[model samples]
Every structure is written in structure tokens, then in C-alpha cells.
Target: MFKAYFTDGGNPSDLVQLARIAESVGLDRQRAEAILASDEFTREVRQEEQLWLSRGVSSVPTVVFNGQYAVTGGQPVEAFVGAIRQIMSEAKGGTVS
Candidate 1:
């Protein structure tokens, strides 16, 4: 869907384009088209968006670790490594300090 919308300049809301994108991703095109045409996943995606909004997420590529530490936006590799180290330390019963 993202590839279709951003890269291919196709409408993400269009089921045909969505099916094509899904197929490109090695997914079942027919099943993907059916799901896109149906209202089944709409509520799920909306719920996830609402949850992100409630969590103060207003941007894409937000990374949440263990549902505790959240780092939004694209960051330097060092920043990601630091976050991972911190999360790992915490998981090992040690403080990030």
C-alpha cells in the first residue's frame, strides 16, 4: 500500500492498486483485494491509529520498545544503538544509568 501510494503514485485507497502492491510484496493478491474491498481491517487500522495518537505519536517510523520506551522519527544509528542498549539493560534488571 505504501509503495503504491508513495512510490508508484497510486491511490492507497484503491483496492486494485492495493492488490497490486500486496502481490508485489509476495502476498496473495486475491485475498488482499478482498480484504481491501471489505471493511474488516478498516476498524483494526483505525484502532491502531487511535492508539498511536493517544500515545502522542504524530509521525511515522515511530519505534516503541517493550511498549515502554518510544523513539519517534528517524534518528542516527548511535541513537538507536543507545536506545537498544538502554532497553536491553533494563530488561536485564539493570538501570540505564
Candidate 2:
């Protein structure tokens, strides 16, 4: 999906394109189309969206560590490493510089 969206220039908002993308990844095309056509999982998806929204997640690729610390948006590997170290240090009752 990421490849189709970013590399192939596929429009994710288009159901037909989405179904095609799903089929490309070995998913049943008809079932994918059927699910997209219906309101299936709509409520559950909305609920999850609301949960993230409530958690102050307003961007893509938001990483929440231990449900406490959050790193949002695209970041370098060092940023994630630092976050993990900080979270681990805090868990061990220590501090990371």
C-alpha cells in the first residue's frame, strides 16, 4: 500500500485503485471491492481514529512508546533511538542525556 501510494502515484482515496492495490498484495480483489463498497469496519475505523485523536495524534507515522511518550511525523533513526533510550531509562528510574 505504501509503495502503491508513494511510488506508483496511486490515489488512496479512490476505491478502485485501492482494490487494485489490495489485489496486488495477494488479497482477494472481489472481497476487497465489496468491503470498500460497503460500510464494513467504518465504525471500528472511526473509533480507532477517535482514540488516536484523543491521544493528540494528528500526524502520520506517530509512534507511541508505552502509551506515554509519542514521536510524531518522519524522523531520523537517532530520534527513535533517543526516544527508546529515554523511555527505557525512565522505566529503569534513570535519565538519559
Candidate 3:
């Protein structure tokens, strides 16, 4: 979806483009088109959006680890490794650094 939207100039809001992207990803094109055309999963999507908004998530690429630590933006691999190490240390009751 990101590639289609950002690189391929495909409109993410268009159901046809969405269906095409879904088909490219090995999903059933007919089912994807049907779902995109209908209100299927609308409530669930809205609910999740609300949940994230409530949690102060106003940006994309915000990764939450163990629901405690958040690493936002396009971070390096080392950043993720450090976050995981910190979370693991915290779980083991290590001193907070």
C-alpha cells in the first residue's frame, strides 16, 4: 500500500487502486473490492483509529514495545535493538536507565 500510494502515484482512497494493490499482495481481488466498496470492517477501523488517537498517536511509524516504550519515526535497526533490550531489562526488574 505504501509503495502504491507513495511511489506508484496510486490514490489510497480509490477502491479500484486499493483492490489492485490487494491483488498484488496475493489477496482475492474480488473480495478486496467488495469489502472496499461496502462498509465491511468500517466500525473496527474507526474503533482502532479512536483507540490510537486516545493514546496520543498523532503520527505514523510509531512503534510501541510492550505497550510502554514508543519508538517513533523511521528509526535505525540499532534503535529497535536498544528498545527491545531496554524492555527486556525492565521486565527483569533491572535498574531504569
Candidate 4:
């Protein structure tokens, strides 16, 4: 589970454990394990890392509003509500300060 990484302190020890976790979340274990062990997965992971790096996402829990306004890191419920309201307001041709 993602909670294993974020909420708890459980980190994957190896590709096997990673695949196990994926399986636990309903992914095909054998297929996921095979993919994880391949160079394709490594390249895909690296590409995702680079993509996030270019997007100024250096950490987890980053939330974006219409791909324009971003609330990074851990935030409160009110913060999310505020971002959503602002985006909605902008979409309705209303300005948000």
C-alpha cells in the first residue's frame, strides 16, 4: 500500500518486495515482478523521476489545480478546498487574489 511508504515507515527492501506490494494492491504479481526486473521498468522509473524534477516536484504529496496552481507537500483540508475554489472561480472567469 502507499500508506506503507508515506503513512508508515515501511520501505521496499528489493524488487521482490515491491512486486509483492503491487500484487497486494491487485496488480498481477508475476507480470509486475517480471516488469520490475526488466530494464524497461528502470528506464520508465528514471523517466518519471526526470519528469517530476522538471515539474518542480521534488517531494511527495504534491497536488495540482488544473495543472496551474500547485500545493506541494503535506497540506490541510482547508488548503485543498481553497485551491479547488480558486480554480473553479478562475474557470468561471472570476479573478482570485
Among these predictions, the greatest TM-score belongs to: 2
Q: Model 2: which residue pairs collide?
A: none
RMSD (CA, angstroms), candidate 2: 1.9
Which of 2 and 3 is ahead in lDDT? 2
Candidate 1 residue spans exceeding 4 A from truth: 1-7, 95-97
* Candidate 4 Cα errors over 4 Å, as ranges: 6-9, 95-97
Per-residue accuracy of model 4 over 1-97 as CA lDDT, tens digit each: 5777668767766777788788988999999888877776777788878877888987777986765578898999999988888888888899665
Which candidate would rank higher by TM-score, 1 or 4? 1
Ordered by TM-score, highest first, the candidates read 2, 3, 1, 4
**lDDT of candidate 3 vs native?**
0.87
What TM-score does model 3 achieve against the real structure? Answer: 0.82
Clashes of each: 0, 0, 0, 0
Residue-wise C-alpha lDDT for candidate 3, range 1-97, written one tens digit per residue: 9998789888889988889889989999999989988898999999998987788777889998776578889999999988888888888889545
Give the TM-scores of the predictions, in the order they appear. Answer: 0.76, 0.83, 0.82, 0.74
**Clashes in candidate 4: how many?**
0
lDDT winner: 2
Against the reference, the lDDT scores of all candidates come to 0.83, 0.92, 0.87, 0.80
TM-score for predicted model 1 compared with the true structure: 0.76
Superposition error at 48 for model 2 (Å): 0.4
Error of 3 at 23 (Å): 1.1
lDDT of 2 by residue, 10-92 (tens): 78899999999889889999999999999999999999999889989999999998976899999999999999998988888
